[model samples]
Target: MGNKRICVPNKKEAPLFSWPWEDLNNYKYLLYGPLVSKVLYSIYKEEINNVDTWCLHILTLFVLRAFVHQLWIIYSNMLFLNRTRRINQQGVEFNQIDAEWHWDNFLILQAIVASLIYLSFPSLANLPIWDFRGILCCLVLHIGISEPLYYWIHRLLHCATLFQQYHWLHHSSKVTSSFTAGHATFLEHLLLCIVVGIPILGTAFIGYGSISLMYSYLLVFDFLRCLGHSNFEVIPYKLFEDVPLLKHVIYTPTYHSLHHADMATNFCLFMPLYDKLWKTINTRSWDLQNEISSRTKSRVPDFVFLAHGVDIISSLHAPFVLRSFSSIPFSIKPFLFPLWPFTFMTILVMWAQSKTFLYSFYNLRGRLHQTWAVPRLGFQYFLPFAAEGINNHIEDAILTADKLGVKVISLAALNKNEALNGGGTLFVNKHPNLKVRVVHGNTLTAAVILHEIPQNVDEVFLTGATSKLGRAIALYLAQRNVKVLMLTPSTERFIKIQKEAPLDYQHNLVQVTKYQAAKHCKTWIIGKWTTPREQYYAPSGTHFHQFVVPPIIPFRRDCTYGKLAAMKLPDDVEGLGSCEYTMGRGVVHACHAGGVVHFLEGWKHHEVGAINVDQIDVVWKAALKHGLNPL
Candidate 1:
C-alpha cells in the first residue's frame, strides 16, 4: 500500500459558539452600538423613562467614547512607530541627512494639524475622554485614515522640485539598510505622521465611532506597522497569513524594504490596497543573486574616456558621410566615380610612398644641416636610420658624431645578415669611438638591461620607432633617472601611444621628431622588419596569434592501463579460471599495448579511460610521497 500523507488542521479554526461568551459579546455590542437604540428599548420596557435626562446621558456617552478612542489610537501608533525605529537602529549605524530641514518642516506641519484637530473638536474634550470605547474609536480613525493619506502625500512629495528640496533627504540612503528607514528630518517625520493621522481621524469621526474606540484601533495598527518596518521577519503566529482579512490588512518587513529601494512604488502604509488601487504596488520578487552576478559581469575599461571618444567618432562620422552621399543624385554620382576612384587611389599610393620617402628626406636634411651629432652635455640621440635603411644618412650620422666628440651607441641592425652582406659595418669599423649593442631574446631580458644601465651614461638612444618595447624602455630609463631621446620616421604613432599609455617618466624621457633628430649631430639608422604572421596572415597587424591543440590519446591510454593493472587480483588459480583469466589477460594486454603504441605514434585524440587511469596513478603517487593515506 502507498504511504499515507499526514494531514494537519489549520491553526485559525475556532468553535462556532459558546452560550455565556456569545451573550457577553451581544451585551458589549448593545452598550457601544448606538444611544437611540438603547433609549427606545428602555422606553418600551417601561424602565425609568425620563426622556430629557436619558437623552443627555446618551449624548455624554457618545462624546466620551469618541474622545477616548481617538487619544488611545494616536498613542498606540506613535509607540509602534518609535519601536520600529529603535529596532532598525540596532542593526546599523545611522547617519542623519538634512537634519534641520527635515525637522523644521515636518514638525511645523504636525503642530499645525494637531492644533487644528484640537480646536475643531472641543466638545470631545468635555466628555470622559479617557474611557476605553472613546479611545478605541479614535485609534481606529487614526490608522485607517492616516495610512492611505500618508501614501498619497508621500507620493506627492516625490515630485521633481519637492523631492529635491525636501523628500530627497529621506531617500538619500540608497542601500536602505535597517537604520536608514528612520534617518529622516524631524519636520519630514512630523509632516508625514500628521498627514496620515488627521485624515484617518476625520473619517472615523464621520463614521460615528466614539473617539476612545478609534484610539484603541490605532494602537493595534501602530504595533503592526512597527513589526512591518523592523528588519527582523519573525512572525510568531503562523495563522496570521492564513486569515484572509488579517493577512490583507497587515504589512510584512520585506514589503517596507522594497518601499525604500523603489520609493515611487509601495506607498500604502498598513495595507497594499491604496498602492494597488493607484497602480503603484511592486510585487516583483527581489533576486540578490542575480544583482550580484550582473555587477561582477560588468567590465569597466581602464581608459574609459578614450574608448568613449573612439565610439563617438565612429558613430557620428559614418552617419554624416552616409547622409551626405545619399542626398546626391544617382545620375550625378555615376559621373563622379572616375574622379572619386582616381582621388582615392592617389591618396592610398601617396600614403604608402610617404612612409619610406619621408624618413629619407629627414635623414638627408639632417646630414646637410650638420644636425646628426649628439652634444657632450649628457644627451643620447637614438636615430632610427638603419630601420629605414638610408645608408647615406647613417654615414652622415657617423661624421657628425666624430665632429661633435660625443660617444655614439648603435643598436645593431635587426637584419644583421643582410646589413653585413651590404657592407654596412664598414662605417661602424671606421668610427673607433662608436659602440654597438645588440638587443636579443625576450622582452623581460630587455627590461633587465634598462634596469642595469651605468649611471655615468648620460643618455640612452633607441634605434627604432617608439612602440610597446620603446615605451617599456622609456619607463625603465625614467625609473633609473636616465634621459631618453629617440629618432623615428615620424612622431605620429609615438605621440598617440605616449598619450594612450602614459609613462611616469617624470621628465626623464623626451621624444625628438624626425625633423629635430635630423637637425641634431648624431643619428642611428634602425631597420624595420615585419613578423611572418603580420606579413601573410594579418597584413594590417591586427589579429593575435594563439596556438591550441587537441588532447593526446597516449596520455589517456597511460591512465587506463596504469590504473587497472595495479589493482589487487584473486589469489586462487581456480578462482582466476572462473573469472575468465584468458579474457582478463587479453584486456590488460590490449590496454597496456595500446597506450605504448599511441605514446610512440604521438596520437593527439582524447582517450578518456587512459587519461583517468594515468591521473589516478599520478595523484596516488604524489599523495603517498607526501605521507598522505586515504585510509
Candidate 2:
C-alpha cells in the first residue's frame, strides 16, 4: 500500500478515453481499455515492494476466484436459465433436448481439481475496501487493468500455430458454461490471472483501492467472466439498440458466443471495442447469435454453393483449376495430402484425351469448404475449368455439394451454359437421390445487376446488351422509366433482344448504342463484357455488376470502381456460407447470390435457364431486403 492516484494519460494520446469522439459512448470513467498500460508507464509507477508479497497477492486472488467461480457454476447449473447448444471443432452439435443437465458434473470437478496448485502458496486473505469511492475505482480499475494485457494475449492465443496447442482447451466448449470460463491449461490460467490481476495490483500497490475492493474485484470479475462465457444472453442488446453509442460500450454473451462458433473474429476480453479498432469484429455477430440459438429450424440453411474461379475465360479461371489439378489428387493420394487433407478438399481426377475430347487438362478439381455454424452450412467449392476451355466438372462440383447437404446448387458461369439449354438438367438427371436442384443463377444475377444501378443516375449504360443476362438487365431498368444506354457489339442483335423480350426500349427512353456514351451516365453496369482490360473504364465511384466472369477486365489501376454486392449477410439467407474469406475474392457475382435466392423461395427441383424479365424484381427485392446492400 502506497500513495495517491499516480498515473493519468495525456489528453492527446488517449482517444479511447474520449466519449462520442468516434461514435463511442461517453462513460463517466474516461480511463478504460488500456488504462493499466498508462498506469504502468506513468511517472508514479513503482517496482514490486517484495516479490513474495506480490506472488502471495496473485495466489490469493486466484484461489478466491476459483472457489467462488466453482460455487457460481453449481448455482447457475441448478437454475439453468440459459443453457444452449454446445458447439465443437467440426461443426457437429447435439439437440438441446438431447442434452442432460448433469453432463457438466465432471467439468466442475475438473475445474476444482485444476485449482489445487494454489494450495502451495502462503495463506492470504481478508483484503478490505477502504472507502465508498474504492468500490467504483475497483470496478473501473479492474477493466482498465486487464483489458489491454488480456486483449493482446487473447489475440496471441488465436494465432493459428498457438491456438491448437494452448487455446483449444477453452474452446472445447463451443456453447460456454460458467465452468468453461476458466477451463484452460495451467499456463493459460496463470497468464489470464496475470493479465487480469496486473491492473488490480497496479492500482492496489499505490493504495488506490482497499483490500476489500481487491477481493470484491476478484469476485466481481469472476462473476462477469462467467456471465460472458454463459451460453445464453441475459442482457438485452435491444435495450441499447436505440442508443447507437451506448450499444458499443459493453459486451454481450452473444458477442463471445460468436468467437466460439466462428473462432476467427471477436477476440477481445470484455468489450468488442478493441476488436472494432482492429477491424476483426465479425460484422454478423448479432445475426449469428439469433441464427445459432433460435428455436426455428427450417430457417436454417439446407445447402450452400461455393466455387473457385467461375466463367469461360480459361485465361483467367484456368489458373485456379490448374493449380488444383497439379496438386496431389484428393481421391487418389489421400495418404500424401498434408494438413486437414480429408476435411474440405473433395477432389476427382479424370484423365482426358481418350477420344471424347481434346484437352491437356487431366483432372476436374473441386474444393468443398466446411465452416460449420449449425447443422447445415453453405459449401464453398471450386469451379473445374475456366468456362469453355475444358470440360465443365458440373458433376464433380455437384457431388461435393451433395455431400455437404446442398439441396440446391448454382452452376456458376460456364457451368450454367454446360447444363442443357442453360437449365441444370445434366446435373438433375444424374443426381436424382440427392434431390440437388441445379440453378443457372442467371435470373438472380440479372436481378442483382439491375439493383446495382444507382438511383442518382438517370440512365444505365449496359454492355453486352444482346446477351442473355445483359438483355434482362436492360429491359428491367427501361420498363421502370429508367433511361437505358445499351452497348452491344451488334446493333441488329441488340434490337432483336429488345424485340425478343417484347419490351420496346425506345418508347421507354432506352437508347441502344455501339460502345459510345451519351448523357454522361457515371453509373455503369459491366454485364457479360469481356474485351481486353483497357475497354473497362469508369469514374471513381462507379458500381459495376460485371456478372459475367473474368470479372470486369480486372479494372484499371488509375480508374476506381466500387464492386457492389450483398455483404455480411444475415444467416437467414438460405445456403449462406462463411463471410470469412475463402478465396481470392470476397464480394461474389450474382451467380452465388442466385443460389441463395433460389434456396429462400423454396424452389426445389426448379431450374432457371434464362432469367425472365418478371422474376428480376422479386429476386432483387428479396436480396436487397435481407443482405444485398452497398457494403
* 191 Cα displacement, candidate 2 (Å): 9.2
Worst 10 residues of 2 by lDDT: 356-365
Local accuracy of candidate 1 as per-residue lDDT tens digits, 426-512: 554455444321111113223223323445655554434354345545555556666666545566755653454335654665676
- Candidate 2 Cα errors over 4 Å, as ranges: 1-301, 310-392, 396-406, 417-434, 501-514, 528-545, 553-560, 571-589, 623-630
lDDT of 2: 0.49
Best by TM-score: 2
- Report how far off residue 466 is in candidate 2 (Å): 2.8
Residues 1-631 of candidate 2: C-alpha lDDT, one tens digit per residue: 0111112244222212211221222231232223334334442555433333333444455556666655554433321122232222121122110121222222232233323322432222223446566656655765665675687888898897566566655665444656567555445655765765565555555556565666676677678777777655556545555665644566667788778777778887776777787887888876655444553222122544534322122211111222221121112233333423422232211123111111111100121222111110112122333332222344555665576466676654544553222456555655567666667777776765565566666767676666677777777777777777777657667666667544454554354554446325566667554454424445544545565444555445544454533333343222111122222112344666666557666676555455678877777677666564434
lDDT, candidates in the order shown: 0.35, 0.49
Candidate 1 residue runs with Cα over 4 Å from true position = 1-91, 94-116, 119-121, 130-145, 174-194, 199-225, 285-631
**What does each candidate score in C-alpha RMSD?**
33.6, 19.3
Q: Could you estimate the TM-score for every candidate? A: 0.28, 0.41
